[model samples]
Target: MERDRGRYVPGGRESAHQADYLELFFDLVLVFALNGLVNRIVPALTTDDLNVRWAALFQTVVLALPLLWLWTTTGHITSRFDPRRRLIQLVVLISALGLLIMGTSLPYAFSGRGLAFALPYVLLQAGRPLLFIFTLPVGDAVRALYLRSAIWFAGSAVLWIGGALTTEWRRVVLWTSAVAVDLIGARLNWPVRGLARLPASAWAVERGRHLPERYQQLLLIALGETVLALGISYTNEPATTETTIGLLTAYLTTVLLWRVYYHRSGEMLGEALDSVRGRNNLGRITGAAHIVMVFGIVATAIGYKLVQQHALDRPFPLWVVVILGGPALFLWGRIRLERVVFDRLSRRRVVAIVALAVLMVPLAFTSALVAAIAASVVLFGVAAADARRSAGRPPEAPAPPA
Candidate 1:
C-alpha cells in the first residue's frame, strides 16, 4: 500500500496508527467475553440478592481493569509504531492472547474460580509491559513512554498476584487498588515527554488517520455491545405487543446514540485533538474522554437490559429515568468535548433531556412502560438534533504534509 504522506499532518493525522479491522476484532472478542460474564451476573441483580451483586461487581471490576489497560496501551503503541511491521505484529498477537486470558477469567475472578482467573490476568497484565520494556529500542522518546508505563503495569501485576492469594474481599480490594493506581499513574505520567513536546514527526506518528479509525471502530464495538445486550434480554422474555414496542424503542435509542457519536462529533473531536499542542493534552482529551464515553456506553447497555426486561411487565420509574437520562450524559460529554454547545442545541436533544425529566414526574404515578417510552423518544430527538447540527458544519480540513 502506498503511504499517504499527507495523512501524517500534525493534529490532522495522529490517528494514523489505529488499525480499524484489528481493533474491531479485538473489541468483538472483548464483547463476547464481557457478555458471557454479564449473563452470569445479571440474574443476581434481578433477584435483588446483595451477595450476588457484590460478587458480580467485584468480578466485573477485576476483569475490566486489564482489558481497559490493554486497550489504552494498544492504541498508544499502535499510534507510534507502524502496525505493518513484523515485530509489531508479534507484539500485538501476544497482547491479544493476554487479553483473551483476561476476558476468560471474568466470571472466576472473585469466586471459587480465583486461581483460574487471576493467573491468566497476571500474565496478560504483565506481558505487554514486559515485552515493550525489553524489545523496543532505547533513545527514542516513545521508548521512554513505554518504560514509564511498564512501571505502572508492574505495580498492577504485584497487586493482582497478591489479590489472587488472599481471601475474597481482600482480593477485590487489592485488585481494585492495582487497577486504580495504574489508571491514575498513566494519566499522571505516560504522555509527558513525546506528547508534551509535540515534535512534528512524533505527532505525525501518533495522531494520524490510523488512530482516528481505531477510535471510530472501538466506538462501534461499544454500540454493538449495547445492541447485543438488548437482543439477549428481548429474546429471553415472552414477546408481547408492549414488549415488542419497548424493545424497538430501546434499540432505536441505541441507534440514535450511535448516530450522534459517529455522525455529529467524532471526526471534529479527532481533528481538535490532533491540533492540540502536546501529545499529553491530546492523550488527555482523546484518550481520557473516550474512556468516559465508554463508561456511559456500558451504563446505557445495562440500562437497556433493564428496560427490555421490564418494559412490558414492570418498568420502574427509575428504569425509565436511566434509559433516557443515560444517553443525555453520554452526549453531554461529547458536547463538552466538542465545545459546541450554545452554538445551537438541537430541538430534538433539548426535548429528549427535558422530556425525559418531565416524564419522570408522571412516571412516579403511572406505568413504568409509559415513562420508558417517553424517555426513549426524548433521547432520540436530542440525538437527531445534534447529528443534524454536526452534519451542517464541515470538518476541519487536514493540514499539509510536513
Candidate 2:
C-alpha cells in the first residue's frame, strides 16, 4: 500500500477548541451506563456479611470495566473526529443507542446477558473507527491514527465476542482480559512493528485542550449522579433530621469534589498538560484517571443511597467500602493526576487520601451516614485550606518543557 506522505498533513490550529454539542450528548450515555452498573452491584452492599458483599461488589465492578472502557474510548474517538458533520452526529447517536443496549445487559452481564452486552460492544469498537476513517478527509494524521486504532479494536472485539459465546468463569476471564487489552493498546497507541507511534499531540494541536475538557465534563456528570441519587432516594420516603443531615453531607461531598478539581488547581494542571508539547503522557494519565475518578463518584453515589437508608446509624460493616472507599479512590486518582501534570505533590491531598484510609478503620464502627460525613469533611478541610493558601498567589505560568 502506498502511503499518502504529502497528503497526511497534521491538524491546523484554530482560535479556540471547545467540545461540540454532539460530544456532550455522547457523554450523556456514559452517565446513564454507569448508573445501570451501580444499580446492579450496589444493592448487594446491604448484605450483612462483609465478605459476601465485598465479593459480590467486586464481581460486579469487574463486569462493569468493559463499559467504562467503551465510555472513555468513545470520548477519544469523538474528540478526534469532526462532530460538525451530520453523519458524525448520527454515528454518535447510534453509538449512544448501542450503549443503552449495553446498559440493559449490565445487570446480568456476568451471566445470561453476556452476548447482549458483547454484541453492541463489538459493533461499536469495530464499526466506529471505520466510520471515522471514511468520514475524515484523506491525508489527515488523525485519520491515520484511527486506522492504527481500528487494528487494536478489531483484535479486542474478537475476545469480546469469544467471551460472549462461553459461560461461567471462562466468560469472566475472557472479558476481563479483553478490557485489559483495550486499555493497554490505547495507552501504547497500538504499537506494532513498522508502524510509527504518533505522539498523542501529533493527532491534534487542539486535542490537548479538547480532551481534558471532555474529561472534566465527564467528572462533572459523575458528580451530578451523586446529587440525583440523593434526591430520588429522599423523595420516595419521608424525610427525617438524619435524612436532612445526610442530604447536606452528600451535597457537600459533591461540592468538595467540584472544588477540588474545578478550582484554580484544575486550571494549573491543564496548563501544565498543555506545556508538554509531545509524548502525550498527560492525555494517557487523564484518560486512565477519569475511569478511576468517575468510578469513585459512582461508588460514592452508591454509598449515599445506603446512607439514606440508615442515616446517622452505624449498622453494617460493608458501609466502610460503600462510603470510605469511594473518596479514597477519588483522592488516589486526583493525587496521581496532579503528580503527572504539575509534578508537584499536594500535601493536603496526600493527607486527605491518607486520612480517608486511616479514618476508614475507625469510622467502620460508626453509621454509614457518619462515615460519609467524616470522609467528605476531610476533603472539605483540604479544599478550604488549599483555597486559603492559593488565594494570594498568581496563577502559574510554566514554560513548555524542552
Candidate 3:
C-alpha cells in the first residue's frame, strides 16, 4: 500500500488542474436535474392556491440545496483527488447516477418517492467517503477528513431515511434538518469530539483552476436550463406572437445573466484563486455565491415557462415574483462574488437589483410577458454598464485578500 501512495490521490497540489472529461459528464446530469426542479415549481406557481404556491417555493429551496450539495461535494473530491484514476472515475459515475435518481424522484419527493430520494442521497453522502477511507493511506489528512465527514453523514442518514418514512410536514422537517446537518458539518470541517479536524493545508489549492472551472461550469448549466425551458415551452404550442416575444425576452435575460457574471469577477475567478490567500475560504464563498446565482437562474427559468404558457394573461403575484425575483437573486449573488474577487460591489448590480424590486409593484399587475421583459431590461442595463466600464480599460484583475 505504501507503494500505491499518489496513485489514487495526488501527493500534493503541485500543478494547476483542468477539469476532466468525467467531471463535465457529471455536470451534464445536473442539467437534467435542474430542469426537473424548474418543472416542479412551474405548476405550483400557475395554481391559484396561495398555500400550494408558497409550499412549492419552499420546496424549491429544500430540494435544490441537497442536489447542489451533491454537486459541490463531487467537485471537491475531483479537485483533491486524481480524477483520472479508475477508482475516482467510479465515484464520479456513481454520483451522476445518484443525482439522476434524486432528480427523477424530485417531483414526487414530497409524495410517494420520498425514500427513493433519501436512499440514493444517503448512499452517495456516506458511501463516497467510506470508499476513500479504506483506499487512502493511514494517517493521511484526507483520510481523517473523510472519517469525520462519514461520521457526520451517518448522523444525518437517520433523519433523511426517517423523513422518507413519515408523511406531510414531518418529512419536510426531517429532510430539511438532514440537509442542514450536511451543510453545516462541511462548513465546520466535519468535526468529531475525539478526532483532529482538517489541517489548514487541506484547504489550499494545488490545482487552482480546477475548482473554479467546475463552479463556472455549474453557472453555465444553470443558464442552459433557462434555454431548455424556453425551447420546451415554445414547442408545446404554436409560435404565437406572445410566445415568440417571451422566448426572445427569456433569451435576452439569459445572455445578460452570463454577461453580468463573467464580465469581471467571474472571468477572473481562476486568477483570483491563484492569487488569493485563504484560498479554501474563498472557495467556500465562491461556491455559495454560485449556488445563489444558480437558484436565481432556476427561478428565472420557471418564469420563462410561465410566460410562454400565459403570455398575455395577467400573472399571479408569485409569477411576478419569479420573473423579477430571479434576476434580483442573481444580482445579489454576483454582488457577493464581486466582494470576494474584487473586494467591492458593482454599482450597476445594486442598481439593477433595486430596479427589479421596484418593478415588482407594477409587474404584479401586468402580464407575465411584460414582467419578463421588464426584468430583462434591468439586466440589460447592467450588462451595458459592464461594457461601458470595460470599453477602453484592460480586464480587471482579482483583488482577493492576501
The candidate that wins on lDDT is 3
TM-score of 2: 0.88
The TM-score of predicted model 1 comes to 0.79
Order of candidates by lDDT, top first? 3, 2, 1
Error of 1 at 395 (Å): 6.4
lDDT of 3 by residue, 236-272 (tens): 9689999999988888889889999998799888988
User: Going through the candidates in order, what is the number of backbone clashes in each?
Assistant: 23, 2, 1
Model 3 earns a TM-score of 0.96
lDDT of 1 by residue, 1-402 (tens): 122332221122233445745655666776776565556555555555556655664566466556666776676656666665555556567667666766666666676666666666666555655665555444444556556666556777788778888888899888788778777776666444444422322123264556656666767777788888878888888888867886887777777667677653575545645554554444455555566566566657766676566664454444544555566667655554444312233345444556666666667565546655665666666665665655758754433112
| TM-scores for candidates 1 onward, in order | 0.79, 0.88, 0.96
Q: Candidate 2, which ten residues in sequence have the lowest lDDT sum?
A: 1-10
Looking at model 2, residue 390 earns an lDDT score of: 74
lDDT comparison, 1 vs 2, better candidate: 2
Q: Report the C-alpha lDDT of model 2 over 1-402, residue by residue, as the tens digit.
A: 122443322233242266788777777777778777667766777776777687677767776677777776666655654555455567778888888899888878877888889999888887877765765566556666777878888998888889988986788778778888877776667776776655443223244476677778888888876777778888875698888888899899999988887665455655766777663655666666777888788889888888888786675656786688888788778876676566667688888888888887788777887898898889899889878987889865643333
Off by over 4 Å in 2: 1-16, 49-51, 134-141, 193-208, 268-270, 312-315, 398-402
Q: Name the Cα RMSD for model 3.
A: 1.9
Q: If both were scored by TM-score, which would come out higher, candidate 2 or candidate 3?
A: 3
Model 3 residue 244 distance off true place after TM-score fit, in angstroms: 0.4
lDDT of 1: 0.60
